[model samples]
Target: MKITVKELRLILTVDNLDELIHFYRDTVGLETSKEWHEETGNGIILDAGRASLELIDSKHAARIDQIEVGERVSGPVRLALRVTERIPEATETLIEWGATSVAPPTTAPWSDVARVQAPDGMQITLFATSTLEDK
Candidate 1:
């Protein structure tokens, strides 16, 4: 039988949850769908617009790393976010918000992309396309 999936949520247990929340929600502009600051724990769910799971083999992953970052710097999981435009500006903004720049914006076969390492060490790829048709 085929099981249907509803939504995908990438849950990250971070040490600096507030900092990450600011980086993702405030700086990156993801809408906060829900948040909790009870005695159990503090957590916030930011709406990432849309989500999809991308699987890549080691060879292809390395190739992408080389093209974007000029080195193999990402781990098994990487976050690729599609932006409306201005990848360079967004990348710089992310860097100023405490994310480390893995690479500046570069033109790729698919879109203009930039890589940044989040404060929690998650490698994020920011790609810009004019519209969904362009994507």
Candidate 2:
């Protein structure tokens, strides 16, 4: 048998659902893709640009951590976001909205990245890939 997938989305089960919704929509700037409440529970899906499933093992995740933050994240899950050159300014604004800094902006071999903890306690890496070669 063969299977095909069309779209992918990240579903976060958070204690503060409404707060997370506001954070991702207003703070992180992701538009609301879909939201609904069934008899079971409530769900909110935000449009994280160019969604794709990234399945990585611990070793690979550690490598990514080393490259991005010069260290390893304590958990198995970490969120990665690609932003523009305005990362510093954007990160400052995000911090104002309740995100705590895990690491300051660092220029890595692959991209410039910053590690942060979201209001919901998720580890996030804000990154920018555009280099001098891209200009």
Candidate 3:
């Protein structure tokens, strides 16, 4: 038997729903498709444009951190997003929106990447396909 999955959503169970929503929707510029609230919990779905599901062991995840962000992220999971341009500006914007600047925009093997930590301690990598010099 086979099962078909329709769509994938990255659900972040956050301590402060409003702040997380603002960070992703306003700072990161993802469109908010829907939101819900209950007495016990709340959730928001932001449009990530395109998504890929990756499964890896802890060692591989650490290696990806070393390769992309130049350091090993503390957690078992990391979130990455691809942006068109202005990665430096985007990183700064997120910082202004209350995220911590983990690393400045730098050229990685794949693209120009910037690492930032959300208010809830989620490490996010923002990247663009073109080099920073070109952008």
What's the TM-score of each model vs. the native?
A: 0.92, 0.84, 0.83
Q: Which 10 consecutive residues of model 1 have the lowest summed lDDT?
A: 126-135
Highest-scoring model, TM-score: 1
Report every candidate's CA lDDT.
Answer: 0.89, 0.79, 0.80
Stretches > 4 Å off in candidate 3: 130-135
lDDT (10s digit) by residue, model 3, range 37-133 = 8896778889887777768898887776787667776586778777866899888888899989887788877788889888999988888763333
Q: How far does residue 92 in candidate 3 sit from its true spot (Å)? A: 0.8
Q: Which tens-of-lDDT digit does each residue in 26-133 have in candidate 1?
A: 988999999999998899989987677888999999999999999998999899998765998889899999999989899988789999999999999999763455
User: Whole-model lDDT for model 2 versus the true structure?
Assistant: 0.79
How far residue 130's Cα lies from its native spot in candidate 3, in Å, is 9.8
Over 4 Å off, model 1:
130-135
Worst 10 residues of 2 by lDDT: 126-135
Which TM-score value belongs to model 3?
0.83
Worst 10 residues of 3 by lDDT: 126-135
